[model samples]
Target: MDVEEENIESDASHNSNELGDTQRLHITKYPSQFRALANKFAHEKNLKDRRKLLEMYGNHLISFKRSILLNRKRWQQRYLRRQSFLRSVFMQQLLELETTFLELIPILNLNGMPSKNDLRINHSSDVCTPITRFYKDLLKLESDDWLAKFHMQKSTFDWLCGQLKENGQFLGKNSLMGKEPPYERQVALGLYAFATGIKYLEIARIFKITLRTTICRIMKSVAESIIKTFGDQYLYMPTSEEELDEIGEAFYSASKMPPVAIGVLGVCEVPAKQQVNSNSIESENSTIILQVLVDNNMIFRKVKLDTNQPSLFLEETNEITNLSPKLIKNQPVSRFIVTPDTYYPLRKSLMHKYHDPVEPHEYDFNEAVDHLFIFRDRALQRLFARWRILKCNGDIDLRTMEKVVLACCVLHNVIERNEKTFNEQWSKGPHSDNTKYTMSSRFKPVLNELHGKPHSWKADGASETRKLLGQAIYSTEM
Candidate 1:
């Protein structure tokens, strides 16, 4: 079974490719390079040696094939078995990945990479030296154990067996390393669960174990293995210019177009259960407000006042007065504008704060999304695709025409829903027909206006040019 013979066997399987399924074929039936490797290393020299080699390789191949088949089977079976279990596992894994990934997102920000000065050792930090010393000492001992465990193979067992035959004291040498083998089954099952979005509790039911124990075992094993294998390799702040450039490139690639003028709005929602007390009732109310920032093709230039202690303020301070002196002196293509009915009033002292040179006031958020939608309609009218207004968590709930239409505005960045208004309206409703007509009629022309814009034929062809991106950033501060 050389490479040429392996290809011949693979060509045989090609005939069944039209069957439109590959899972049914056992892996051993499809020849691989491993077969040649196995034959070259086979124990015997006779004709029977080749047969024995094939048999051993066949078993290994079958195990590999079963692993693949089981993955697809588990995904299809997950929903039918236990729905709650699957949902929890999916949510947990998704959240875990999201949280970890976002921490590194500042690296991908429009602002250039942090300087060497930024990452320079802070000798002033009291705990840094002690923590570094502790980890350095610990890793030495841990590395030895890891290396020893990793290399203990069947050869080690065979060596011990030979020693046992020569001396009585070494009779149980093979049994000296009495530690149980690693939980390969648990690791395999955990990965299967992750890839297929299967729940540990459902897996527990399949394996005849308790739900709690199964979940604990799967998470501990899977998370620990992932940490040990990768171990903060990709989990670092970008300190170098090249690394920062790579991060920015990834962001630009994901975002497609550089955000012309970025409008960031944070929404905070509180659960119903937390609203029992009066103070909690007020606190449970979700807050939604917009932040105006200048996002050129490059980094996000946050307009801050000199007196403002780099505050993450939700209140929208007035644009003309509160901007940095340089921005006021030379307004860029974009100018920042905070909503008037903001949580607070724009103070007089705040008005005279540091203003940087801005690309004079030829830009605003009012026209940004609206302009995009207008462009979307003219250029993308012929496209056929489902238009969804997804929530922050990516749940699409477009049940009504108003919901559908509103979602279109949000998706295309035409009109941002006043979250407070929508929430109040939705919550106060008594399922009145008049209310539906009122809301729908009010926003109907807005949608019609969006759809009625003229197209420029000289530009790109009438393809799906405007692929709408709708991101709802929710605030967890509440």
Candidate 2:
């Protein structure tokens, strides 16, 4: 048996050696295959463990996701609540601020209540105490000085004041509360200041008024009052036959001609500053033409103003044509006769004696008689020069100028009627014989036919009238 065992052992040893050798050979030949098989087995084991872990934690993951979603929703709700609370607080604050501002408005004294000094400066200075003092000073002046300054005597001023008071409906009373200036004083100051062309500042100083605008208002009020009071009384045509006869007699006395000679026609040039409306027509000499008709007594029968010199003559004729038919009762009164220097239209009815040297005798005779008629124009000129306001040398517009002239004319008539003697300065004797006739460019050839077409019959009638008048005039010596 021992021998058999020994044999078996030897064989096993040999087999073991053979196996080892074979294994070595395989490893050397296929090492990559061995490594890949090992890796595949390890990966499969890891995948199996991971799948087990996923199965175990699946419920936990779902619960965690739900909890996160709920927490996020809670945070969002908290944020919205905080924003709403802030907005409400801001609105409440704004409302409170608005209420506070409203409550404080009345308590804030913005313009500091006017002091006593301010009241005195504003009200007392403009009231009537100063005016009373001014009137007292005016009364202290002599009658001649008063007349020279104010263009009317004290008695006349008082009469005018009384008349205006009697006709108080025309000049409304001053509504100012504090003792107001007397109506007479206000009217006198306005008339004197405007007629004399005194500066507003100068007038304010004289009257002790505080404001220049006050003087201006006073002037305008007084002027309108005067016009309303005396316009119709003084500025009307002789209405009755008796008045017409009287005017006719005055004319006959003036010219030594027949009663047919009623008035003289004339023009005066008033220089004015440039007007604001550029489209308005302006004369070449920058003047406004004033056409005036004066009766034998040197009273303004008619007055018209034209923008240009050329239009003045036509306007005068139109005025005369309108007025003549109303005045004359006998015939249609084809036209009227006047001693117009050369500017007047030469119609059969309107006879103009030329100032040519050839007709010396006729010229001399006419000149001697024409002097009486021409005196009216000279007197009118002097009257205009006397009223500086009517002349309007300063900045005055057309409307204001018209008012000034009309007012002055009314005042002129008033003074003329009231005064016993004529003012020597305003009314000098007849113009000198050596005075030369001045021709104006206003007389153009186109304007010659303005008086309408002349007929032979009209000319014959006018000539006969003139001849009879000339015979009558020459028969009587001046």
Q: Per-residue CA lDDT of candidate 1, range 274-364, in tens?
A: 1112332112212111121212122112322111112333233433334322121122212122222122222221111112313212122
Query: lDDT of all the models against the reference?
Result: 0.29, 0.53
Q: Per-residue CA lDDT of candidate 2, range 237-263, in tens?
A: 554546555666776666554455445
| Best lDDT among the predictions, by candidate number | 2
Candidate 1: worst-modelled 10 consecutive residues by lDDT: 469-478
RMSD in Å for model 2? 37.4
Q: How high is each candidate's TM-score?
A: 0.22, 0.58
After superposition of all CA atoms, the RMSD between model 1 and the true structure is 30.7
